[model samples]
Target: MASGQKKKWVDKMVFRAALRRWAQAARASHRMELSELREHRTRARRLRAHLDKLIHVAEERLALPMIGNQAFPRPVDTDWAWRPELWCGPLPVPGMSSVASQSMLGDEATMFHDCAQSELTLRQVRNTREADLAAYGLRMDVFRFDGSYLSLAIDLPEEASRGLKRSHLIRIDTIVEMEKPLEIFARLNIKHGPNTEQIVRELPLHEADINVEFDLAYTKLNEKRVEKLWLDLIFEGPEMNQVVLRDLTFSRRKRAAL
Candidate 1:
């Protein structure tokens, strides 16, 4: 072959080699950027752990309880305005996800989720107190969320509701305080099927978080209709009080031995 022809062939081979090298370099650059992004995500996860630890320490000192610990964290919905104090963490930058776990939903303060709802605003009446009781050493600070719609909901799980029947006795340990003497009426909503039926009963207003027994003899849990139930402790008259509902539990009306 002529020298000129040979030289042209060499040039073509060199150009192809250069193009391949450039393509490889581009791929390597993309991989490095991807790796860096992954590292950043890992670092953010560590930061979340650190922030949660700080919250736990602070709550221990102030006696504040968080919402959930081991349970799955709830995605932020209407909670952006006022999150539980313990959830204060580095603001999640856009394009990043925040990790959370169910921590302390059952404390003195109001809880606002389904796992352990202790809504501070779950008073039976919107702005009134029972007629026969006065505030009895119940202390709470309005230092937190002003839109205090934190009404507590007592969740009756499916299993519990299924086992429950009419005439079943329920033992409750609660603290009711009133500003004046009046009788407090308790309104309970037992959800049966797709319907919500209300049952109203009266309890004497005592100025203390007291223990009471709710005899289900008259409650008449419609076996065919009773799906689940929630109680609303209604303060009949005007007496500003905080009722510390400790627990609302049930005991089967055990059959007597023959």
Candidate 2:
């Protein structure tokens, strides 16, 4: 064969070898892309399935007996966006009240962080409500040995808690240890969007369980919103005495929710 022809044939063989390697690389890349697409679709399908289950659970809870009644009150039904495990279910008996609650050091629910002020102990905890009693009724066991023992509850207002600058009422029920007759103070923590303030008032002059309810007709709210709130129960008297708080609950009326 002529030398020039032989050289041309060798060049053609090299070109064909390079073309085979490029084809193999292209096929591998295409397979990898297809596998990734499949994985993404699987993940999306799982997420959608989970969301469906959550929605179903929320709807079921809204159907429970007297879901929005006073004692067994229902959580605020916001728009269908995020759902918390705390909301969708037959609520574990409200051992405290319809909404937020607080107790002294040894009291029920959970002990407060500060110990320098008073020492509170949990005496008993009730999870169920009696037929003759109110909703989410709890018999919280609490006794104060060093300082004042205060238990508080804050109930949310309607209108999605919007345009409300302050709490509608401050309710206090206390069992105090009398050392020359003590005095207790109750404060309402109200927040409206960016503004937060404390509304404080002293308890009645007496012993035993003093049930107090404050009206919010005085506080002004203009295009306000309430997202969080609480109450502080303070006792003023001799530092050493024992006080007991039995039933602390939130409601529209003095009677318990059925």
Best by TM-score: 2
TM-score of 1: 0.36
Per-residue lDDT of candidate 2, residues 142-182 (tens digit): 33344334443333334324433233343444333343556
CA shift at 2, candidate 2, in angstroms? 99
Clashes per model (N, Cα, C within 3 A): 26, 8
Stretches > 4 Å off in candidate 2: 1-120, 125-180, 205-209, 220-223, 252-258
Error of 2 at 190 (Å): 1.1
lDDT per model, in order? 0.41, 0.44
**What is residue 208's positional error in candidate 1, in angstroms?**
7.1
lDDT accuracy of residue 161 in candidate 1: 59
